[model samples]
Target: MKRHLLLTAICIITITLLNGQAQAQNLRAFMQNSGFLSLQTDTPYAETYLSVPGNSIVYKTGANGKYEGALEVTLLYLKDSNTVAAFDKYILRSPEIDDTSNITFNMLDIRRVSLPDGVYNVQMQVLDINSTDKEPLTLSQGLNMHFHRDSIDFSNIELIDSYAPTTTKNVFSKNGYDIKPYVFNYYPTSVNKISFYNEIYNLSKMVGDEDVIINYSVKHVQKDAVASNLFRFSKQKAAAVNIVFSEFDITDLPSGNYLLHIDVRNRKNVQLGEQNVFFQRSNKNSVGELSNISLLDVNHTFVTEIDPDSMVYFVKSLSPTAEMYEREYISTILQKNDPKLMQQFFYNFWQKRNPTEPEKEWAYYKRMVSYAAYNYKTAIDYGFETDRGRVYLQYGPPNHIDGSDREPGAYPYEIWQYYKLSNNQSNIHFVFCNADLVTNDYALIHSDALGELNDPRWRFKIYNTFKDGNGYRNFDIDYFRSTWGSQVDQYYGK
Candidate 1:
C-alpha cells in the first residue's frame, strides 16, 4: 500500500516596520510532503517541498544591502509522539529582489530525510525570519514507512514540475536526473502535461528470469475506469529496482478528480503489485466534448424508461459528483429542457461510469439520491442542493462525525472525518455549522480535504467570536486558540 501524506497550514504573523512599529499581516505559503523507499540501500526517506509566494513575505535588506526574504524551517519526526527519531533545521532564502513591489515569482525549496522503517509523527515548523513574529507556523501529520526487501513493492509516485539529465549531484538528483518536484497535486489549465516518477522494487526477486509488463494509466476517481486515451505499457526484463518515469498530455482531459495508477504483471498477465496517486485536473477546453451529446442515441437505453417529469431532477442530482464539464452540460440541458437531450445525456453519463451495466450503476446512485433527499432536504432546496447532502453524495458517508450543539460561545457544529477518500486521500475532514440555530440545515464552513473550502480561521466563524468594534469578525487574531467552553479543536483533530 502506498502511504500518501498531505499537510497544509496557514499562519498570521506580525512584521516590524523600519521605525520599530509592528503590523499584523498574513504569511502565506504551501508545503507538500511525501515518503519513498530506496531499494539500493533498503532504506526509507521523506521529501518536503515548500512554495512561498514572493509577494506574501516581507523582504529585508541583508548584509549586502540587497532585499531578500528568508524562512526558518524545522522538521521533526517523532516516534510515538514523544521521542524524536529524526530532525532537520535550516534557513531557506529567496532570490534577491531589486524591487519588492514587483515581486511576482514564487520561492521554492526541497528537502529530504532518511529514516528507519516505522510509523512516526511528522511536525513541520516554518517562520518568516524577516518578520517580528516569534512563533512559527506549525503543522503535523502521520508518516508510515514500511518496505520489505523480500517482497515486491512500489515507491510513492513523485509528480515532477521539470526534469533534466543531472550534471551535478544534489538533493533533487535521482537516477541521473535532476527533478523539480511539482509541489501540489492540483493541475490547472496552464499545466498541459503530468510528469511523474516511481520505482518498482524487488521485481527480479519476485519474478525470477521473467519479463515483466509495466502498465500505467490515469483513471477516473469516481468510476474507477481507465480514462480514454491515457493508458500505456512497457515490457522490461526483471530487475531489482525498475524506474518508471513518464508524462501524460492532459490538455484535453476533462476536469475532474483522477488517479494515476501503476500496475505490475508477470508473463501470463497475472497481477503482481499496483499503486496509485491522486490528483485533480481543471481543463475548461474539455467542455467542448459536450457538443457530441447531440450525436448520442437513447432510444433503446435505460434513460428512455425514466418518467419525463423526473428527468430534470435526476440529472440535477448528479451535480454533487459530476465532472466540471458534465456540470456545464447539465446546466445547458436543464435550460433547454429537451427530454430527448436529457435522456441521451443521462444514459451516456452512467454508460461512461459502468459500460457493462450502466443501468445497475444508476440504480445504486438513485438509492443514494433518495437517501439524501429524505434526510437533508429543506424548505427551499432538495437534499442534493445542500452542502452536507452534496458532500454525502459525492464522497459517500463519512467514517466518523463529531457533533456539538450546546457548546458555549459556539454554534451547532459537526465535524465529519473520512478515514480514506475515493481519491486515496486519508484522514480528511469537513466542518459544518448551523448558525441559524433553528433549521437542520448545516452549512459547510471548512474542510481539510483537497479541492474543498479550507479556512484556517474556521473556528471563528463557528463560534462567532473575536469581532472588532466595527462589528465585523476580526480575522487578524490568533487562529487556533480554543475559545472558552468550546471543544472544536478536539473535535476537529479527532
Candidate 2:
C-alpha cells in the first residue's frame, strides 16, 4: 500500500509539469510591451495576425459526435525560426464571442495602424487549448513606417513679408496659420549664401491627423554652386511659422549674389509650392552705433590677465559697429596712434571678468564680442547691435559663420549665417540697426562735447536709433571708411 501511494503522488506531479509546459504561450506578452512591436502598415491588402487575449476557450471541430474540440493557431512571425523562444506582441480589440463552434480560426487578425515616421517590427500568435491535442499557431511580419502627407495652404496664398524682427502678424487669414523662419550662418566673407525667412503656414490643420513635410535649400551663383542644407518638416496643425537661412556673413562677402530655393509639401505627399528668392550681398555695410569709452594710454603699462593680441582683435572688431564718436575713438585713439595702449586696455577689460586662471569662460565671451564687432559693424559702428550680438552674448560665436554684405541703400540690408552649433542647429538673417546717429552722431558730430552721456541706456538708445533707421537717413561712413580706401568710392558704390 505504501509503494502504491508513492507512485500515485509521482504521477500527479508529472502531469502538472506537463500541463505547464504545454501552456507556455508567453511570447504574446513579450511582443506587446517591447519596442519591436509596430502597428504601422503601408500595404492595404496586408493581412494581420494575433494571439487570443488569454488561455481562454477557443474551440474547434473534431472527429467525434458529442462536440469533440481542440485549439491551435498559426503565426507567420515564428515561421522563419525552427522554435519559438521569446517575442514582443500586441493585441487588437477582440470581438465578443457568442459561440466557439466550427471555429476553424480562433485568433485575432492583426491589422496595421498609422504611426509617426520611424522604424518598427510586428508579430502575432494563436494559442491551442482544446481536445488535449495540437500545437499553437503563430504569425508575424516586419514593416517600415513613413509619415502620412496632409495638405496645408496659406490663408491668403500671397507671398509677402508681414512682420519685423520684434513683431509679426498674419492678417490675410482670419483663422491663423503656421510659419517658421530659418537663419543660416557662414564665414565672415562668404557671399554665396542666399539668406531668406521661410514661412510654413497651416501646419496646425494636420497636427494630430497627418504629417506635413517641407524641403528647403540654397544654391551659390558660381558654377560650383554650393547649396544650402536641406530642411524637412511634417505639418499636422495650423501654425504661423518663419525660418531664417544664413549661408554667409554680409560684411565679408563679395558683391555677387545667390538664390534661395524653397520646396513645400504636405501630408498627402503633395508638393504644395516652390519659391525662388534672389538675394545679393555687396561690400557697403552698415551696423548700429555703439558706445565709446576713452582710456588712458596704458599701451606701455601691460596687463597680464588677457593676451595682448586677442585684445587688439576684440577692439578692432568693435570699431566697425561703433558710433561716429565711437569710430573716432577707435580710429584716432584705438587703432591709429596707439596700438600698445589699446592692447593693454582690451587685456584689462577681459581680466576684469577673469580674476583667476583656467576658468576661462571669458575666451568664449571675447570671441563672441569680436564676432559681433566684425559682423555688425556699420560705416560708423560696424555691425554691432544685430541678432548676432544678442546670440553672441547669449551663446558665443558658433563653430562656423558664413557672411555677406551689400552696399547701403542698394539691397537694403546685410546678413550673417551661423551653422552647426554644438547643439546641432543652423540660423540666418538680415542685419539692421538705427542707433548710430542717436546720441553724438560721430565724435565730430556730438552735440555735447564736455559732458557725454554716461548712461548705458542712452548708449543703447543711440544704437537702436541707428539700427532701426533706414540707411537713407541715419548711416554715415566717411570717417571710418577713409582709413580703408577712398570714401567716395564706397559712397558711390552704395
TM-score of each: 0.75, 0.21
lDDT of 2 by residue, 37-127 (tens): 1213322121232323333333333333222223333322221122232233433333333333223332333233333333222334444
lDDT score for residue 467 of model 1 = 33
Model 2 residue 465 CA deviation in Å: 54
Question: lDDT of candidate 1 vs native?
Answer: 0.79
lDDT of 1 by residue, 292-364 (tens): 8889877887788889889989999999989867887899889999999999899888997789999999999
Best by TM-score: 1
Which stretches of model 1 miss by more than 4 angstroms? 7-25, 39-41, 63-65, 80-83, 132-135, 294-312, 331-344, 351-364, 378-381, 385-388, 395-494
Error of model 1, residue 234, in angstroms: 2.1
